[model samples]
Target: MGMKVGIIGCGSITKFRHAPEYRANPHVDEIVFFDRNLQRAKELAQQFGGRSVETIEELFNDPTIVAVSDCSSNEAHHINTAQALLHGKHVLCEKPLAISVKHAEEILKAQAASGKKLMVDHNQRFTKAHQKAKEIIDKKELGEVLTFKSSFGHQGPESWGVDKSNATWFFKKERSHSGVAGDLGIHKIDLIHFLLDDEIEDVHAFYAALDKVDENGKPIEVCDNVVCALKTKKGRLGTASFSWTYYGSEDNSTTIYCQKGILKIYHHPEHQLIVETKDGAVIKYELEPIQTNENQTSSGVIDAFIDCIIHDKEPSVTGQQALASLKVIEKILGENGI
Candidate 1:
């Protein structure tokens, strides 16, 4: 029998990612959608061949729902995910886990008490390029990695949010808390953690609202750009930048300096992973194009979530793993006075 899935939000994340992915999952036979705006819920339900729930309570109370995808606003991640977990459903929550570490811990406690699985949608880890990179690093094919730099930047959420405007909740401090750090930076932080198999031990960051403006043509309240230097527990050094003001094409790239070679990701158009060794021997692996809002592609997150549930195994990106990345985000926020 296929599992029944509940989607807690009907925003851009849900529309572009969760809903369609869940519909495509062979193990998912039913999907239920809930949104604060009833019409939004109805519309997604109609489009995805699912049912529209009038209230969050209605969605949670349904005993048939075996899992939930919490794609709500950043501010609601904790509440919505905890409620679903407590209601006996495995949850796949969108990243940053929670706006605060305290809230994230609370969700973890809820999962522990409920004996349910909790996963974070750190979709970058599921990318083919990133997976291949992990393989190379694990096999010591690049030798011992020493230093690295990564970045995730684009035009801004205004181009993709459900409302598609500066008025979106992403610009509201109360709703988003930390801007690019939480939205884009955290993904790379998680990716680094996944790739290096090490945790960031320290962070120093600089952030500013570079160029994004509000509905009134004034600077938004949140940081639109961030650059940081980080050190891992293993003494590996790295730099990262996140931005909502990369007016040109998106640049999601990272380069790792290792003892034997340099591993570059997303640095080539045809080859997603490339290595140039000390002897000048170069190797390239052709992988799928990076998935962006404009260049949509399957994330492999929903499928992984379902496979974990079906196999009764822990999610690849667990809540605790996400918390480690969130701690780094908190450190950066503290340094910036955000």
Candidate 2:
């Protein structure tokens, strides 16, 4: 039976990634969209060959919706996802699960009570390079992963958001809460967690609103840059930086130093994964280029979500997994006085 899906927000994420991906999924028969701005929902519905519902309650009450994608802002994820789960619909929430760890737990609790699946769109985990890297690491090719550094940065969301305006919700503290840290850093944190199969233990961070400015040329209220020193539960140490002021090409790169070798990810244009062994051998694996706002790629996230629902398997990026990353983010923000 074909499944019907609901999208909770008609924001950039919904327009660029989730809505299109779901429309392409064979298992998804229909899509219903709901947004605070009814016009936005109607526009996405028209563009994606779906229908717009006036209210979230209306969308959730529909018996046909088997699952929902909570593509709302960081602050709305908890409420939207929890309500969906309560309505007996599986939820695939976007990154940073929530602005706070407490909110993330609330969604998890709702999922537990409803006995429904709750997935998170930490899309980095589904990338070809990261998948291949995980396989190599699991085979002991790296010989005891020791330490790592990862970063995710770009020009800024102003150029990437749907409206392409500095006045977007991303710049607002109430909506986004933790600027670049929550926007880009959290992805790397999730990537490290996925690759090493470990959780972060402690974090010391420095964050500030470095460069981005509003129409009045005032600095943005939220941090535009964040750099953090991190330690894993297994005692491996690392550093990470998230920024909206790269002012150059996107740099979503990571390097893992192990006992026998160093694994460089996204370090080269042609080679997505590079290994330099202590024995002085170099191995390079060319993989697909990373997806950006302009250069779209199949994230494999929506497909995975659909397949998991159809086959009754657990999603690769579960709510519980995301909660761990959120906790680390909370610790970082707490330390930095965010």
Candidate 3:
């Protein structure tokens, strides 16, 4: 029998990545959705041919739902995901995992007590180019990775939110907590860890609420831009930046300078992954473009989450790994006194 899963939110993530991916998954036979805004839930359910629940308790209590996706806002992830795990449902939570490391740890403790799978959607690692890059770095084929620079930027969440309006919760400090640092920076932090198999040790960051305005035409409470220097446990150093005011094209590029060569990711439109060796040889892999607010594609997170459930295997992005990344984000924001 196919698995039935519940999604706790009906936001843009549920609309774009989770619901559609679950619909396409052969293992996922059914989906149930619940949102604070019941109408949004109904609309998404109808869009994906799923059922909409009026209350969160309905989704949690349904025995048919073997798993749940916690796509709620950052602040609600701790409560929603922990409760889902305790309810005997495996969970796939969206990125940042939690706004604060302490809250993330609380959820981690719940996961340990529940003994069910808990995965986070750090979807950048699921890319074929990124996976291939990990292979090269792991094998030392590119020699020792020394230093790097990575960034993720866009026009801002207003363009990507479900309502497509400036009033989106992404600009609220109470709701978003770390703003672009949590939204975009955490992905690069996790990606760096995934590529180098190392953890960030120290951070020095600067952030500002430069451009975005809230629904009331006031400056956003949270920072829209962040630039930081990071040092890993393995002594690798790197610089990272996150922005919601790029104003031009989405820039999700990462360039790693190794001992023998340089690995450039998303730097070229056609050659998504490029390798430059000291011998003046260039290797290009024409992989699919990275998915953005404008360019939608399969994220592979839902498929992987379902595979882990069916096979009784560990999820690709575990709760602990997510917590580690959340810690890094916390360190970055803590630097800025946010």
Q: Rate the local accuracy (lDDT) of all candidates.
A: 0.93, 0.91, 0.93
Q: Model 3, which residues run further than 4 Å from truth? A: 335-338
TM-score of each: 0.99, 0.98, 0.98
The segments of candidate 1 whose C-alpha lies over 4 angstroms from its true place after superposition are 335-338
Ten contiguous residues with the weakest lDDT in model 1: 329-338
Number of clashing residue pairs, candidate 1? 0
Q: How many pairs in model 3 have backbone atoms within 3 A of each other, for residues 3 or more apart or on separate chains, i.e. clashes?
A: 0
Give the per-residue lDDT of model 1 (tens digit) for 175-259.
9999999999999999999999999989988899989988989898889999999999999999999999999989999999999
What candidate 2 gets wrong by more than 4 Å, as runs, is 335-338
**lDDT accuracy of residue 141 in candidate 1:** 86
lDDT of 3 by residue, 140-202 (tens): 997999999999999999999988999999988888999999999999999999999999999
- Residue 115 of model 1: what lDDT? 98
